[model samples]
Structure formats: structure tokens, C-alpha cells
Target: MSVQEPEARATAVSPLGTLSLHVTGASGVTIDVAQAQVPKLPEGMAVDGVMLICVRLAVQITRESPMRIRATADQDGHPETGEWLESMAFANGAGRLQVAMRDDAWLAARGVAAEPVQYERQGFSQVIHEAPAGTALYVSAAWRIDCATAAGDVSAWFAADLALPA
Candidate 1:
């Protein structure tokens, strides 16, 4: 499989320090992952040997000061052949999040007319993974924050390991 960049993502103005990920129990940060589901596509819309699962996450960044945050994911399950999906960024706050998709043929075979990154849900964004059946998904959310403080220009990360039901 291949990953494609739909558009150029924004970068932190003054990124500094080491990148970090704040999971549950981390001060002012909480991440909630929804159940993984193998979505049912329309009739004749499925690609042969390609299984798609939707992973949803709702991350609340309750820091007092606002900063620009960006989100990206890596298919850690297969590092060597891992895919680097598209990156999503929020202005002064975290907004929608979506990973990069496979190659054009992979998408075209599934009858996708355009890049599927324009949709957003109530407070969460869809992260569609193209993993083989009976495999676990290890998605790492690499977050970059651009704070105005001298000591606050650092990147952080939070990992979500979801076991797909066989």
C-alpha cells in the first residue's frame, strides 16, 4: 500500500524541545478512543483483499493558553512498509483529524471520486486504516504545538493501541 498527501500541512512556527504525548492522567489532557468498526461500504464498493476499519478519537486539550496543534499518524504495525498518511492541523485549537490514504489505484479501485478528507463528525474525526484482517492497529498521534513561551515550543505525542476484533 502507498500513502499520498492531499495537501501541505502547517508547521509550528518555533518548534523546540522534545516531542511528548500526554495520555490519560496527564495534566490538562485526556484522550478518548471510540470502538473500532469495520464499516460497510455500498454494494460493489469494496476493494478485493482490502479491509477498511474506522478508528475514531476525541482528544481534549484543556491547556489554559491556546496554541496551534497538528495531528499525524503512522502505521506502526508495519514499520518498514508503513504508510505516512496526510496530516491535519488546527488553528489556535485542535480540529478535525484524518490520516493519509493509499495510492491512487487503491482509491480508484474502491470507486472513490475524490480524496475523502472533507468530512468531520460531531467532535471527532475519522481515521480509516487499511490493515489486513486479524491484525492489531497501533496508531501514534504525533502532536506539534507552537507556544509563544521560550520553554513551551515542543512537540508531544499520544499513542493509541486498538485491537481489532477478528
Candidate 2:
């Protein structure tokens, strides 16, 4: 009998002008999300005169029972000013999730030019924002299902670079 190697999977690339989320969750659990639109600012109110791109993720998890979830952002080697601006929580049938952003002063101190765009993904969610060049931002989501009978999480880091024209 001859042994055959499995075919290599193709690498997926994120769409231009958008952020992508990768999630891992409990076995037998599934999640789905819709791409979020960028936040709209009032007229004459620009993104602090700096270019920015934001993405929101809406997530839904379907499982047999309830779960606990938490999400956080990790600034990759970037100086943190220790501020949290907004936070909100909500619950669906079997789980709960909260979303938030860093304080304006902290963001300003780090030269983060705009508000974070928040969204959800399979088994996790995310918020993307504009940061200074050479800086990196990390996002993480943790979930516990059936009161910790099964649990998982995902974290991702993205580095800031020159913005491409839309």
C-alpha cells in the first residue's frame, strides 16, 4: 500500500480595509459572525485629523448550555497609559460577552488616532483601531462553556503601518 500526504490548505488573506478574527471554542460548539461597519462621526468631526480604520464583530455561539466569556486587548510591546474608556455587557440564552475600549487619554498618549471598531466572530469577538506606525495591538477572547466543563480562547496581534488609500 502507498501512503499519500494530505494536501496543504491554502492560507486565507483578510480583505483590504477590514480586520479578521480567528476564534477557538469548546468542542461541539459553533459560532458565526457578521462583518461590522466602521463607526460614523458627525460632520466637521474628523478622526482627530488622523487616518483611521475601525471594524466591529458581531458573534453568536450556539451550544447545548450556558457559557462565560471575557475579552481583552493586549498592546504588543507598546507603552500603555492604563485607561479604559467604555465597557458594556450583554447576555443571550446560553452565554454572555462584554466589549469595551481604552480611555481617550491613554489612546491619545499612545498616538492612537481613533476609536476602536468593535465586532464579533466565531467563539470570540474583536475591536480594531488605528495606532501609530511601528506599534502593535493585541486582542484576546476567553470563553468557558458549561461552567468550565469546556473552554477556549484566541488572541491576535496586528502591527500599525501606513494606511492604504480606500
Predicted model with the maximum TM-score:
2
Q: What is the lDDT of candidate 2?
A: 0.26
lDDT tens per residue, model 1, 33-143: 332332344343221111123222232222332112123232111111112332222223322122222322343354322223322221112223232222222222222
Highest lDDT against the true fold, candidate: 2
- Write one digit per residue (lDDT tens) for candidate 2, span 55-154: 2212222333212222322211112112243332222332222233344355457654433433333212322233323333322121112322121111
lDDT of each: 0.24, 0.26
Candidate 2 to truth, TM: 0.28
Query: Could you tell me the lDDT of residue 72 within candidate 1?
Result: 29
Error of 2 at 17 (Å): 23
Per-candidate TM-score against the hidden true structure: 0.23, 0.28
